[model samples]
Target: MHVYADPFWLPKQGNTEEEYEDACCPRKVTERASCSFRCAVADGATETSFSGLWAGLLVQAFGSGRLTSKRRQETLRSLQGRWLSQVSAHPLPWFAEEKARCGAFSSLLGLELGEASICGGGRWWRACAVGDSCLVQMRGDAILSSFPIRDSRAFNNRPLLLSSNPGRNKEATTMWTSRGGTWESEDAFYLMTDALACWFLTEAEKGQQPWRRLRDPQTGDGTFAELIAELRRNGRMRNDDVTLLRVTVD
Candidate 1:
C-alpha cells in the first residue's frame, strides 16, 4: 500500500511555537509504500507543569508500539516513571515542585494502518484514544467513522486525560477506547487535537463538507499558521495549540 501522511500544527495565539504544548509522532510529511504505519497525536494540558514533555513521550511510545491494549496499565505505569525521572532529574522551585506532584496530563490518540491480506486481501486500521483528540475516517465525500468524541457538543473544558502520575491514571486508562475498520484505496484518516477536532465535528454536523476544508486548506500566504490565525480570529476555531495529522492510503 502507498500512504501519504502530513501533519499541520500551530501554537496558541500569544504563545511561541516553543511553548506549544502538543505533540505528534512522525512529525514530518512523507509519502511511501509500506505494509504498516503507526501515527499518534497528543495534547498536553496547559495547566500542568512539564505537560509538553509528557505529551511527547506519549506519542513516541504510541508510535513505537510500546503502548498497547495488552497490559496497558503496566505499560503506562512504566511510562509514568519515565516521565517522573525526566521531570525530576533536577530540583524545582517550591511552586513547581508542588505542581509536579499533581503531575502532567494529556490527551492521546493513536492510529495504526496496515495490509490485511489474510482478512481477504484488504487494508485495515485500528485506533485507541484517551481523550478529546479525535480520529475521523473518510471515504469519498463522507466520513466513515469518528472516534473518542463524535459530537461537537460533547466537547468541554474538562476531558478525561492520560496522566504522568500512576496513582492518577487508573481511571484514564480504564476509560481509554479502541476501534478498528477496513481501509479503502482512497480512504483518508484525520487525527486532530481537541480544538480543531471540535470545529471539524461542528462543521460536519451542519451538513457542511468540513473534510474538504482540511484536505485543501486555503491558508493565506500558503502557511498553516496564517490559516490558524484566521480561524481563531473569526471564532471558527478555539484559541489553543492546534494539530492535525492527515493520512491517506492508496
Candidate 2:
C-alpha cells in the first residue's frame, strides 16, 4: 500500500507563528509512497511553562516507539527529567520558575500504520490518545471511525493531559485509550488538534464531510490559513493553535 501524509497548521489569529505551541512528529511532509510509519501530535496547554518543548518531546518519544506500555511511566519520568534539565539551562524569572515547578501539560495522540499479514494481507492502523486530539478514518465520502472523543459536545476547554511532572501524573499510562482497525486502499485518516477537531466534529454532526475540504490536493499552508481565517472571521471555529495531519492509504 502507498501512504501519503501531509500536515497543515496555523497559530491563533493574534499570536505570532513562533508562539504556536502545538507540535507533531515526522515533522516533514510525506509524499505518496510504500512504507510503514508512525506519527503523533501534541497540543501544549497555554498556561503551562515550556509547554511547547514538552509537547515536542512527547510526540518524538511516541513516534519513535519509546513510549510503550511496558516503559510508559519510566519513559515519562525520563522525559520529565529532560524537560527540567532543559529549563534549568536557561535563566528564568521567579514566576516562570513557579510555573515550572507546577509542570507543563499537553494532550497527545499517537498513530502507527503498516501492512498487517495477520489480517489477510491488508493495511492496518493503531492509535492511542490522551485527550481531545483526535483520529478519524474515512472511506470515500463516509467517516468509518472516530476515536477517543467522538462527539463535538464532548470537547471542552479542559481535557485530561500528560504532565511534565511525573510525580503528579500517577495515572499517565492508564489515562490513554487505544484502538486499531484495518483500512482499504483508498481510506484516509486524519489527526487533528483540538480547535480544528471541534470544528470537524461539529461539521460532521451537521451531516457534512469536512474531510473533503481537507483532502483537496490544493490544500496547503496558504489554503489552511485562508480557511481558518474565514472560520475565525465568521466565528465558526475558536481561535487557537490549529493543526491537521492527513494520511491516505492507497
Candidate 3:
C-alpha cells in the first residue's frame, strides 16, 4: 500500500500562531515516507499552565512507542518529572507558578498504522484516545468507523483529558479507549481536533460529504484559513485552535 499523510492547522482568530497550544507528532508537515508509523495529536487545555508543552510531550512519547498501556503510568510520571525540570529552568510570576504547581492538561489521540499480513495482507490501523480529538475511517464516500467520540453532540467544551500531574490524573491511566480495523486500497482516515471534528460530524449528520472538501488538494493554508474564517463567522465552528491530520492508503 502507498500511504500519505498531511497535517493542517490554524490558531483562533486574533491570536498569534505561536499562541496555538495544540501539538502533533510525526507531524503533519513531516516529509518522511514510511509504510508503518505512529502518529498523534494533542490539544492543550487553555485553562492549564504549560499545557502546550505537556501536549507535545504526550504525542512525542506515543509516536516513539514509549507510552503503551503497560508503560502508561511510568511514562506519565517520567513526563511529569521532565516537565517540572523544564519549568524550573524559567522564572515564573506568582500566579503562573501557582498554576504550574497544579500542572497542565490536554486531550490526546494516537494512531498506529501499517500494511500487515495478519489481517490477510491489507493495511490495518489501531487508534487510542482520551478526550474529544477524533479518528474517522472511511472507504470511498462512506464513513466506516468513528472512534473515541462518535456523535456530533458529544463534541462539548468539556472532554476527559490527560494531565501532566500523574497523581491527579487517574482517568488517563484507565479510561483511554482503543479500536482497530483493516482497510483496503483507497481508504482514508482523518484525525482532527475538536472544532473541525465537530464541524465534520455535524455536516455528516446532515448528509454532507465533508471529507471531499477536506481531501481536496486546494485545502492548503490559505484555503483552510478562509474556510475556517467563514465557518467561525457563520457560527458553524467554534473559534479555537483547529487541526486536521489526513492519512490516505492507496
Candidate 4:
C-alpha cells in the first residue's frame, strides 16, 4: 500500500511554538508505496515543566519502534534516566531542582500500518495507547473505529500519563491498550491529542461527520493554525495544545 502522513499542530493560546508541549514523529510527507509505516503522537501534561521533552522522547521512541508491549517497561526505565539526566545536566535553584525531581509526564498514542496477515487481507493497522491521546480510522466519509477512547464524555482533566518517575508509571502497562483493524484504499487515519479528540467525538455524537472538515484543515485562509484559532474563538474546542497527525492509505 501507499501512504502519506501530514501533521498539524498549534500551541495553546498565549503560548509560543517553542512552548508547545505536544509532539509527533517521523515528519515529512511523501506519497509512496511501502510495506509498513509508523506514526505516533504525544501530549505533554501542561502542569509540568519540561514535559515537552518527555513527550518528544516518547513519540520518537515509538516511531523508532524502540518502545513496544514486550519491552515497554525496560524502554521507559531507560528513557526515565535519560529525561532526568538531561534536565539536571544544567544548574538549577533548589525549587527548580525539586520540580525536576518531580519529573515530567505525558500521554502517548502510536500506530503501525502494514499488510494484513489473514487470508485475502489487503491492509491492517495496530495501535497502542496510554492515556487520552487517540487514534481514529476513517473509511471515506464515516469513521470506522476509534481506539483507547470512543465516547466524548470519557474525556476528563485527569488522564493516565507516563512520567519520568517510574513509580508514577507502575500502572502504565495496565492503562495501556491495543487495537487493530483492516483498511481499504483511500482510507484515512487520524492521531490527535485529547482536546481535539474530544471535539471530534462530540461532533460525531451530533452526527456532524467531523471527518469532512478534517480531510483538509487547510481550508479558509489556507492554514491549520488559523483553523484551530477559529475553533478556539468560537468556543467550539477546548483551549489546549492541539496536535494531529493525519495519514492516507492508498
Q: lDDT for every model?
A: 0.89, 0.87, 0.86, 0.87
- What lDDT would candidate 1 get against the real structure? 0.89
Positional deviation of residue 35's Cα in model 3 after best superposition, in angstroms: 4.2
What does the lDDT read for residue 20 in candidate 3?
A: 90
List of clashing residue pairs for candidate 2: none
Model with the higher TM-score, candidate 1 or 2: 2
Give all TM-scores, in the order shown: 0.94, 0.95, 0.94, 0.94
Order of quality (lDDT): 1, 4, 2, 3
The TM-score measured for candidate 1 stands at 0.94
Stretches of model 1 off by over 4 angstroms after superposition? 118-121, 171-173, 217-222
TM-score quality measure for candidate 4: 0.94
Candidate 2: residue 91 lDDT (0-100): 84
Q: Please report, as a residue range, the 10-residue window in candidate 4 with the lowest summed lDDT.
A: 216-225
Q: For candidate 1, list the clashing residue pairs, or say none.
A: none
lDDT measured at residue 59 in model 2 versus the true structure, 0 to 100: 94
Q: What is the alpha-carbon lDDT of model 3 when measured against the actual structure?
A: 0.86
Error of 3 at 150 (Å): 0.9
Worst 10 residues of 2 by lDDT: 115-124
Better of 2 and 3 by TM-score: 2
At residue 178, candidate 2 shows an lDDT of 92
